[model samples]
Target: MPRAQQIRSRSISASPFLKWAGGKNQLLKDILPRLPEKISVYYEPFIGGGALFFALASQRRFKKAVIGDRNPVLVDAYQTVRDDVEALIEQLGPHAAHATDAEYFYWMRALDPSSMSRVERTARLLFLNKTCFNGLFRVNRRGQFNVPFGRYKNPTVLNPDLLRACSEVLQGVDIVEGDFEALAERAGPNDTIYFDPPYVPLSATSSFTAYDRHPFGRSEHARLARAYRACLARGATALLSNSDCEETRKLYRGLWVETVAATRAINVVASKRGQVNEVLVVGRRQSAPALRQVGASGHAVTSSSSLRRSRAAG
Candidate 1:
């Protein structure tokens, strides 16, 4: 399908997909253009809500691609949808029709995954996603989905067409449960890697989504920086999205960076949820335009060709 022709607002590329915090549904427009045309495959290490992969794939095809994530259930959801979307859709039905009450949310959240039918399991995943506070998939240390039920009166949980569409797009992808670094180890020439790790808070007061119970602290950030370095050294195209922070800027130092002022939907407080600045760091050179749009809230847009040029020089 033509790249532009396949892009749609409804019915995403994968079905039975989990609604994740920091999923890039909103960033697809900004990040889509930055992607290089000539590439063998696509790799998304932190494939939370695979907004990018599903969006891009809906319009194009890849020779090979790998979607990896730390959440085993999330990864498994993708795999099941890819293999059999219809069955998965069938599995997700109960969750969509579930009561939006708090009690139902807790009950579904605490269900035994082992004894449930595939349909029930799918429904539970969808239920947690829709009813979770602001579509956040936060699990406790015991691996329990613990977010509270949302405030929506009606939610679309088992979207058949969307799931089928997603299954079509996710066909043949190597969906695995692993660290992003392990996935990045093999990214080389003719490959493009897009990193969307759990967003570390730019400020102490701003941290909200704790994707994993284990803190993704400085060490994890350092590990990501090393992965970027590896991707650049191996001549693969790489792009990273993170909250705009001086510390993160320091982490991705000496790389071609572009700042896009975009609306951030995930926030506990309503007033601060309007707009936020995010940095899109790339490990290779590409011509990018300036000033996407003036967000409702104050945000900055900047470009760092130095990092891109450095990758080329190497």
Candidate 2:
């Protein structure tokens, strides 16, 4: 077996997928157990970087899985990987070399996604994602890639094995490019929905991390809160992650919410790097963290449990 095969031998995990900021690489373990076992379909609408999809697809095979993103570039990248990955890898060759400057960022951004063939567009998205600052996919109000160049020495510009593995599970998934609310018409009972929306703006003064040019404001948050409530009323299981902020807690107060700290590269500022507390609000009730163990593997596990299932999938 090849080196990649050894990693694949483990259950589905959150690794191998491209690294991106706000990706759910951490904070999936506790959320997974809360998921119901009889769900016929798995749906993720706000699939930012899709850390959860890649993780869940590893162990179980759902009859139907739907993944979508509002960002057209992100959707195109997933489509190319599922449709034809070889061409994507080939198109990414030019960017495999290093070019750490703001000018290069614009140049890559300017390359038309539709002007190029599908394969070329897919390759461009992959290359920019690998080399861009903090693996972030951000745009300014004018829709330009404004993130600064990240300090990485020879990042994995392309991963042939990983793309192939991801394609295997996405063979028949309904990948779409649209708003999260667009799925409401098709969402049925017993479906599993894992939402990782832009958290209730951690603070009023925080930088713009909105999913799109239009900020997901308080009204939008209330809309989503109502949607989740409706989903629960209709018997759909829901698990969503948001910043452990007052607004978030207030929005989800009546529901069962548990706080767990999952550290990632969210804190761009040097001071707040290691630990960021996020709330995992579930439609179903959870015994408070008072009885759980904050595992080294980024989940709240039972303290007396013996089986140690790590979601890292490494």
Candidate 3:
């Protein structure tokens, strides 16, 4: 079997342990082929669910990696998995035993994650995330997790093997919490940065960008585009994902922008959940050798590739 197939066979361990909204797992087929074969350092600023990171790790793609997210709880979970997986698994034992208990679920949800230890906090988040409505990671103005309990049958509260696998993959990864612009400080030549920021809503009532109190509005998008350009200026290869809207296209004007179908899995209305076109923007390649590698791969996507606008098959 091929390496990718081998990795997929260990689904329990190789795959993302948590279910995430706007996860890239479903789009990997449309993504992996486009990724440059050789990468030195990998960076994912908005590391929600980290599906791409995990997949790359499974393939042993990069030399070193740094992943960050604005959401502190998500960062804590990643840190706990990297540094204290065993303890986190232990902390989740009791919660797993009482997984289906609604009273325990609410009690765990109300318990402030800030007040707990690292392992306890991660366990709390994982339990609440799995039990919450559709596993939505939304918070209010005060940064409090407010999603209500979910309706599901026999949810997997804890998976020790998968957590262990994730921990192993995150061994050398530097996990951080803060704005996406932080990547500008760490990114260097030959580094690969994938930006999976909160998508600009497709419609007026479809706002789902609120991962925390700070919504990713137009200004944020513009700032991210600047950051992307800055990374490219420093000789880093960057790929970004966003809603395939006119504004997003305009924001990333003069870059490689292509549309791919992404399944809408997190919509409140079931009728609205289906295939939707999402944009994939690839930045300019600076190094001659890197450009050669892209050509060898046959994709040959560059800053000017946006002009052709290759339609990505979902």
> What lDDT score belongs to each candidate, Candidate 1 first?
0.71, 0.68, 0.79
Q: Lowest-lDDT window of 10 residues in candidate 1?
A: 305-314
Best by TM-score: 3
Q: Sorted on TM-score, highest at the top, how do the candidates line up?
A: 3, 1, 2
**Residue pairs that clash (backbone atoms under 3 angstroms), model 3:** none
Clashes of each: 8, 1, 0
Return whichever of 1 and 3 wins on TM-score: 3
State how far residue 127 of model 1 sits from its true place (Å): 1.5
Write the residue-wise lDDT of candidate 3 on 1-314 in tens digits.
24553364366555777777899988876666566667899999988998989977877778999999988888889999889887988899889887778888888878887778988988988898888888888888998888888867888988877887788788889999998898656787878889998888778998798788888898999999999878878878778999988788788776767677889889788898889889888764222122211234333345433222542322
Runs off by more than 4 Å, candidate 2: 1-16, 99-106, 284-314
lDDT (Cα, 0-100) at 73 in candidate 3: 82
Candidates ranked by lDDT: 3, 1, 2
Higher-lDDT candidate among 1 and 2? Answer: 1
Choose 1 or 2, whichever is better by TM-score.
Answer: 1
